[model samples]
Target: MKKKGIFVISLDLELIWGVFDKVDYKEKSSYFKNTREVIPEILDLFSEYNIECTWATVGMLFNSTWEEWKSNFPENFPEYQNEGLSAYAYGESIMSPETEFYCFAKEIIEKINATPSQEIGTHTYSHYYCLEPGQDLQSFEVDLKKSIEMARAMNIELKSLVFPRNQFNSEYLKVCKKLGIENVRSNPTDWFWQDTQKDSLKDKIFRTGDAYLGPINKSYSISSLKAEKDKPLAQKASRLLRPYSNNKILNKLKIDRIKSEMTYAARNEEIYHLWWHPHNFGSNPQENLKDLQVLLEHYKRCHKEFGFQSLNMDGVNKQFQNILRN
Candidate 1:
């Protein structure tokens, strides 16, 4: 049973907190709004296809109002060299948590809570950047504590964490382990895909090309995770489910690459972990959903042929733990 192919999907469910340092809120309002709108449909697709996913949401998103957010803010914050990178001084002016403000997502969270086949995981209390220079482990612990508190307030148990921007610090896993995080989504093994604070231009080009070509395939075998004993279950991500594009030929090729990888993993009884943010589908939800359907249909065929099974990060780790215990 453990040798069967495993399919895992994890979503970095940060609407704007994940991109505040990069994108302007006003310009991307529609993009965020569309993201909020399509989450239900995504959940529906998952339910329809028997797929389970872990949504590593920013803990700040649990606030119903700006005042609630301020009240629940973590005591210590990540001390980034750039002040703008820290989200502590926000919410004093231009506050709007009612209609999908930049960071708040109480309503969206409620939707997720009501959905089935989902695991609620933390993306840190403030989208904490682990690999950043100014952040300390103690501060991260504070953030994770706040995350646990916020999720507890919502009657949610967070057992998995996907680091913000894939900035994984090996030392931080102890903090997560102490806080009961059973697993974390690590980046692929290759240097090009290593977790870094600053992605170089060459890295970006390689990643972009890898989406359409098999430059560095991210898929891995289930045995790959069994090797990590001390750290949180390192469920490495196979590939990022990039957003749909207008270019027909390029899109087809990208989907083809993903399908090929998925087929390979299924046939080999390995694990294919695909992840993305809900906002990636914000611009063209329909088109993105269409492509997602193609992947799901492929997964269905793989399941029928090779005993592939869909599991969230938590489920995968649980299965591995059971296997180890036996």
Candidate 2:
């Protein structure tokens, strides 16, 4: 029998919290509104395709109201040198909205919980930036502990983590291990994908072009998905599924590149991990969802013809542990 290729999809499910430091949420209200509406449709498509996925959610999003959110904060907070990076500060600055749709997402989370084959993982309590200056490992630990605690309130055990901003701090792995987190998503080994406080303009340019042109191998062998004992297994992500663009030629090129990479993984029995923020689909939602359906359809074909299997972050980690046992 041939080995099966693995496909993993993770969504960084941070609402406004993910981008408040960089973008003006009030100006992009329509964008966030579209995100709120499109989430269920994304879930529906996942159900239709029997796709398994992980939602690495920001811990504060578990709260339904601003009061609840305030109540759930960790004892210690990340005091980034740049105060703008602090979600706590941002949260306090904004007047509590009548409709807490943007910041709080307990309702959407429940929808995820109700969905089958969907795993809820932590994206840190306040979306803490591990690599950023002025934040220590101790602070990261408390944030992570708070994340696990909040998930438990909803009867969910968070065994997987996706670092906020793809920071992928190796030193923070100890904190994850201490908290019993079994898996984490790591950045690709390529130079352009290096985890850093900020990427150089040259690196950013290459990453953007690479999405449309095929110069990188975005797949990994099963044997490569391993971790040192007592550490959370690091599963490197292959690609970020960029949001739909208006340029038809550019959009086609990007999707084709992803499809080609998926095919290579299937034939080689390797791993292909695709991730994106739910809000990326906010602006061009219908077109984005349509493109997503195309990729899922491609996955279905690969499943039938080449034994490609879809698994969430935790599911992939379990297989890694099983290999260790054997």
Instruction: Report the number of the highest-lDDT candidate.
Output: 2
lDDT of 2: 0.90
Candidate 2 deviant stretches above 4 angstroms: none
lDDT agreement with native, every candidate? 0.85, 0.90
Model 1 lDDT tens row, 1-326: 44898899999998878887788778888899899889989989998999999999998888877778778867777887777777665445447654346678887787777888789999998888888878899999999999999899889989999999999888889789889899999987767787467889888888888788765355787666654545688888889989998999999998988888888888898889999999999999999999999999999999999999999999998888777787
Candidate 2 lDDT over residue span 206-285, tens digit each: 88998998664789987887678778989999999999999999999999999999988988889999999999999999
Provide TM-scores for the models.
0.95, 0.97
> Considering summed lDDT, which 10 consecutive residues are worst modelled in model 2?
93-102
> Which residue pairs does candidate 2 place in steric collision?
none
